[model samples]
Target: MSERKVLTKYYPPDFDPSAIGRTPKHLRKQGPKVITVRLMAPFPMKCTNCGEYIYRGRKFNARKQTLEEKYLNIPIYRFFIRCTRCSGEITFRTDPKNMDYECEKGAKRNFEPWRDSKSGKYNETEEETLDRLEREENAEHEQQERDKMAELEEKMHDSKREMAIADALDEIRTRNARIARNEGKDDEAALDSIHEQVDESLLQAEREDEEAARKAFMTANGERIKRIVEEEEEDPVPTAAPVSAQSKPAASISMPPPSSTSFSRVKKTKKSGNLLGIKKKPSLV
Candidate 1:
């Protein structure tokens, strides 16, 4: 037991080191370098050999090997895993272009809804994609044309509205101008009529004044003549002296007798009032 625990080992003095054989070159260069690594499944898959389902994140001792194929100078790697139930070999490789993995054999990758939706290339052909793009372009063009037509119609309506508003404004301005002209004419005519009425009233007042003065003067002269006639009749006349033959007969001065018809009295009527400082006399009866 002590000897087994000892660190040093005994060797024969006649041991020969050159008798060991070396590995053959043909076997060394036969295949790619394969390394055993512990890894988790990247995606879920179903084993084709046994129809057994394998979920993601399952741990496996996989053989990883670098292949000659490269994408943009980056090395590609292949992984070999075995199904747990049937021990069937499953192979998958890294896809650098798509940044995913592709199953080569012995298994079928499960459908990933998120990945299919993101790629937009699931189960669709090239012709179907072209048709879909063409339909979208046509729909966008039609929409653009409809928008342009709507804009044109809106512009036309705006122009028409502006024109109508301008016409209405013009009509209103003309009407206002005509009304102003008519008002000015009416004002002038009214002033002229008022002046004429004033002048006519003045003329009528002058005629009334002249007639009143004439009637007053005639009444005064008739009264004076009647008084003189009364005085002559009341006094006796003296006898005249005899005229000599030497003096021609002096012409006898004669006066006309006063008559009632020589002057006529005027009748007066009631009047409203006097104008222009003229006073009216009271009526006798």
Candidate 2:
């Protein structure tokens, strides 16, 4: 059978980690003093090399060293430590300007620098004052431009309205003049058409009258010739027996004068009109 070995350690309640025994001055100046602090609360951290988070209240052996550089004329102290996981070098220091400790470069801190700057005694910075003045100047210039535009608009409104009215009136007058000219042209054209129609009608009437006169003359002559022919055919006329020169007058008187109509009765009427209003059919030929 194998036996388990046991080990034990003892300490007193008055233990102090900061207590140091007297040491030689030459040895103290040569190296930085290291300390272990208990974190009151959790702090979130990330390792640069391993990219691991180190939770707050974790123990670390850190060397404390003072830098010659200062912030706000106050000496700054630095803590040098190695990451617990990757042993990556990290450095941090107290920041008096922001009233919070800031990570110099190795890692990031979540503290906001402006938090302490907004105290009751805070004053406006030079940049902030200049930005305010520039804003005011720009606003003033814009207001002046708006005012100028408003004044110009007020003046232009009346002039534009008057010009628009005048233009409308001119357009109306021009339209009226053009319409009058067109009407006059139409009237002149109608009058010329009417005159042409009247002349045509007169010429037609003259031609018709001439044709009627010729027909009437032909009919009268034909009737007279026909009657003469019938009478000669019906009764043979005895040649007047050699009437002596002395009996000539008596023979002419004895024979009744041949019948005839007067020249006036046979004349064709000159009047032309549609007295009966009869519709005559035109010859297709």
Candidate 3:
């Protein structure tokens, strides 16, 4: 067999390449060989092997593959990618439960804590629910701290009240003790003054009685002596006067001799007169 060669190359001025016929819209067009779907990646990713960073919102030409897993009657899909630097295989899958693409292996995404947003109510996702749960936990913790602080404050207030009451009681006790001491001193002073007055009155009464007795004794002695002398001069050698038996027995007399002389006994049958009164003395003249 010989290789045949032919050549005729020319372009007409009226040729329009866009005039070619295309398939009708109603007919089913052939599907593309490279199936692509937009993915939402809200965080940066780093390759596990090469530590290469893939920034957020980056576009990647990933090859799609079917997964055996199914959720809620929807078939799961997987995508395989390669690291730009190391060309290491990276893979991710669609998560129907969380409604986001999850890295199956070979890469790590920056951790992002969940939070609620303005559109969370309309287009709520699993992240929104997680955010609500986190908020509830935080609120519970704050409430607990507030309760502990309130309890501590109450204890402090009670302690302050107790201290105040103790101080008051101590002050009252001291005041009562001082008052009792003053009263005791006053009683002692009063007792001493009363005792002194009583002693002085008793001494004064005793002195008055002694003076009256002395005066009475002196008066009686002078009168008795003068009367005895006159009676002796007038009744010298006079006979003794008679007296009642009861009165004579109750009386006796003793006197000093004025001058020495002889004396005679009276008759035994006659009763003696009161000797200290005006009795006659028998004299030897």
Q: Estimate the TM-score of every prediction.
A: 0.36, 0.27, 0.29
Pick the TM-score winner. 1
Write the residue-wise lDDT of candidate 3 on 15-107 in tens digits. 875686875667747553346665544457899998999888777777877766798789888887778899998888887776777788889
Candidate 3 residues lying further than 4 Å off, grouped into runs, are 1-42, 115-285
- Pull out the clashing pairs in model 2: 43-56
Q: Please report, as a residue range, the 10-residue window in candidate 3 with the lowest summed lDDT.
A: 223-232
Candidate 1 colliding pairs = none
What is the per-residue lDDT of model 1 for residues 1-285, given as tens digits with 9 covering 90 to 100?
899999998878987655658656775657898999999899999999999999999999999999998987999999999999999999999987667888999999999887785666554566877898899999999999999999999999999999999999999999999778667787778678779999999999999999887677666545422333444455667788776655655465445899997788878976655645677788999
Model 3 clash pairs are none
Instruction: Encode model 2's per-residue lDDT on 121-180: one tens digit a residue.
Output: 235555776787799999999999999999999989989999999999999999999778
Worst 10 residues of 2 by lDDT: 223-232
| Top lDDT hit | 1
Ranking, lDDT, top scorer first: 1, 3, 2
- List candidate 2 segments past 4 Å from native: 1-43, 110-285
RMSD of 3: 30.1
